[model samples]
Target: MTRSPFTRRTVLASSAVLASSTALAACGGGGDEGGDTAEKIENPDENINPEGLPIVEEEITISFMSRRSNASAEDWNEVAAAQTTQELTNIEVDWGLVNEEAAIERRNLLLTSGDYPEVFYRTGVPSGDIAKYGEQGTFIPLNDLIEKYMPNLTARMEEYPALRTGLTFPDGNIYSLPGIYDPTSLGLRYQTKFWIRQDWLDQFGMATPETLEEYQAYLEEVAASIEGSIPLGGQDMGSILTSLYGTFGLANHGNDAGLIDLDADGKVRYFPASEEYRDLLSFLAGLYSKGLLQQDIFATDAAAFSANGTEGLLGSCGVQTPSGYFGKEGDNYVALKPLVRNAGDEPAWHAVRSELSSIGNFVMTDKSEHPIEIARWMDFWFGEEGAKLFFLGVEGESYEEVDGRDELIPELLEDKTVDEALKPYVLYLGGWYPGWATDDWFRGVETSEQSTEGSKVVEPYALKEVWPAFTFTAEESQQITTIGNDISKYAEESLAAFVTGDRSLDEWDDHVATFEQIGLADFVAAHQTAYERRS
Candidate 1:
């Protein structure tokens, strides 16, 4: 496959175009007022082919706007996925690719100027805007199109009802499509796990920790025995919270801003304001006081954490894979099952990800001339054949079947990582595209033996029922945004202070009270409404 060269100059040029269009964007934008009716172009019956390749008898080009990461080809025409799709579908796309960083700004400019492209692909339109634009006529609804033309997507919706519930707005219209992952894929089921130094455990003749008390004892032993070692290496504040708080029954999910989850009764509860959260904080503070935890955790990032592990200074850490930290030394680490408060008690909470992403990946604008053909083209990505093409690129060239399994060419992996080698062929690595990601394909092609084994260790403890992506009414969305932002900021700051012993636990009541004053109840109520609507 031929690859197109991408340069820093290309990125700067795209940013320049977005910067120049800001004035026009400021002139007009979405508001309470309804938008203009979408212009309709009658379908040419003779040119349409409903179910198979070559959607249209004659090739027709339509405008498509999408974001491109730095790893992607400079020209979409040269991308193997784009080239092969065009060849098979006979639907030429006039690509309007923008840098990933500037895509949202450019999209907003086009939307406000009333000159948006015919389609938006993988631009990650926010749920609020999906509802806002769908209510207005700016984004044409795809309910009928999906039911009539997209068999693959319709079948998926039937299988996973959450896809329909999450994508549908308050008006009962579907305006966007999402990238769906196989529900059983362990890699996508959970995000992070508690990884510990197996070498240290072996040297000390200690077993894997199972309970909160045992875990703390292990950390204290490591701190006392290993010189200059951080018994529990620091991660980002959110990751640290996510890795530990579940022992106290708080479901953090690694999203500091959206720290709300359903309780045992399936009701919306703000975790940061709960008694369980206070207990978790006190536990962390105790660890900090003993020097068992990293002192500069608030400032520590992934790079710093990895450095500690690489230097053999971390006894344990919370991360997806140790390869990201210790490189070839990752085999010395082992993933631990979620700890419990006491032996024989089950772990109450485990982090999970929604199969359907929160952000919409594909949408049709009012200006499209061939809605049916476009819907069919978009739906192709959901099917098995098209999914393989989009994810693995053209067969035999980018990947080949060996022993009844698809694998990348061995020569491509000699010097470059799997990601680096596939940049010239595949459009996306594992995400940011609207399609169905299967466990077989992802595990076979994208993951390593180490990652797969780590996933297996923690899969049994994962949450069986997770909250699906919820869609709020536009009014509810605005209210949540206005109030939730302040709550999130204040909560994060308070958490850091309390953990570091800068703030005494006696003032915990005052901190909880402040959340109430910041409209925490209202913020939670809006989420509850959305959750109930999904039911």
Candidate 2:
């Protein structure tokens, strides 16, 4: 079988080194920052109580380490919602904020430096890191704490069993708090999609492409009519193709190493090892060979993709949302409905699983001065009052309740945008879910007519069975990392090469064999084990 055009040997070697080195670095240390020698600090406060109100009227302070936008004028303390939280909880926070760009590095450094904050909020801690540190007692398990003090969180877990299942580690311990969004499918049901220039369609009296043939024909016409145009392009062609892979009955859950996902019947199937993947490669290859798609699809960076789209030089693109890549100026581009080559095929497009909650939002360390008090403060976020405060703002000021519905006034959005105005009054930090983000909140805050229309177009084709979020055993985690990194690299390189005709599909058998040689079976099995555990 023909292997991917890239060197798998080099990639595997590099991955092995990185995994080994990082593991060593994480494990080897001395004193406070060192791995085994770092003594876990026990909270000495004897009067701690987590279940009651006014956690501490005596003005206790806790230090937090989290990311702050380098561009925004707002700091954690300056956000109105956080200020109100301080007043309500009677807790002052010493914010140890770092620029967003350096957040991960800074977080790692702080973790290893012996001197760390009491709490980590929206810290982006990886599952591996959480498992590693939690086992070492660097971070304490919150399972008991939640049952004792977090009524809101506990209730939410009871309502959504998956929320608790997703967050629980293999050891049956909960180490982090989660952010729960409102339970609505409208906002959370889809992922990235293809966007096309509607103006070009209108100019040529053409309708949006509905089938693979139609899309290919449209691309040909666009290329023929427009000067120096790329009919199809993407910021990351590999990722774009992966997202669209489901249109051919092969789905990828973006972050996973194994392109294997459970079918409706719960059978494990790997995309790269299937005939559907070949059909996709051939279709894309035909496009590249015909000059209907960008020749340098894989080489093009995000800047170039945006530049082409913004300048109206490209006919279509696959993006997370039109607004993110094209802005309002590229508003002429409309989202494309899922297309199929044949009549009987399912139009399974990329849809991110609807989220009721986000895991790993916050974590408490053993070094915390008052774990119980902090737990109480964090638990407030899950309550009705706290949810309203975080999602909406002060009643009558930011929004008003009419007929028992929270309605936001348009005038409130007139002076400063919803996010801007709400910046001072709430946490509003990315990735931190304080619960209660409703459809109304979306409509009030950032929803535009174009976005609403686009959502409608793409919603029907959303894929149903996505890979659920699950934690891995430490051993399984390392194996997935090393094997997955190499396999994904090979798969991406091979797919791109096949599409571009740099490598022929005639060698496809050899390519499949290469995966086996590189431990594809082991990778798939690891994912299967995790999937079954979650189920």
Best by lDDT: 1
- TM-score against truth, every candidate: 0.89, 0.83
Model 1, C-alpha of 78: deviation from truth (Å): 1.2
Q: What is the lDDT of residue 63 in candidate 1?
A: 86
Candidate 1 Cα RMSD after full superposition onto the native fold (Å): 8.5
Model 1 lDDT per residue over 35-143, tens place: 2322232343578897899888899897899887776777877878888999999989987999888988998778887778778888888777777666656688888
lDDT of 2 by residue, 245-283 (tens): 667767645223236665556666567867788888888
Worst 10 residues of 1 by lDDT: 32-41
Off-target runs (Cα >4 Å) in candidate 2 are 1-53, 71-74, 181-185, 252-258, 263-266, 301-303, 323-329, 354-358, 384-426, 429-436, 442-448
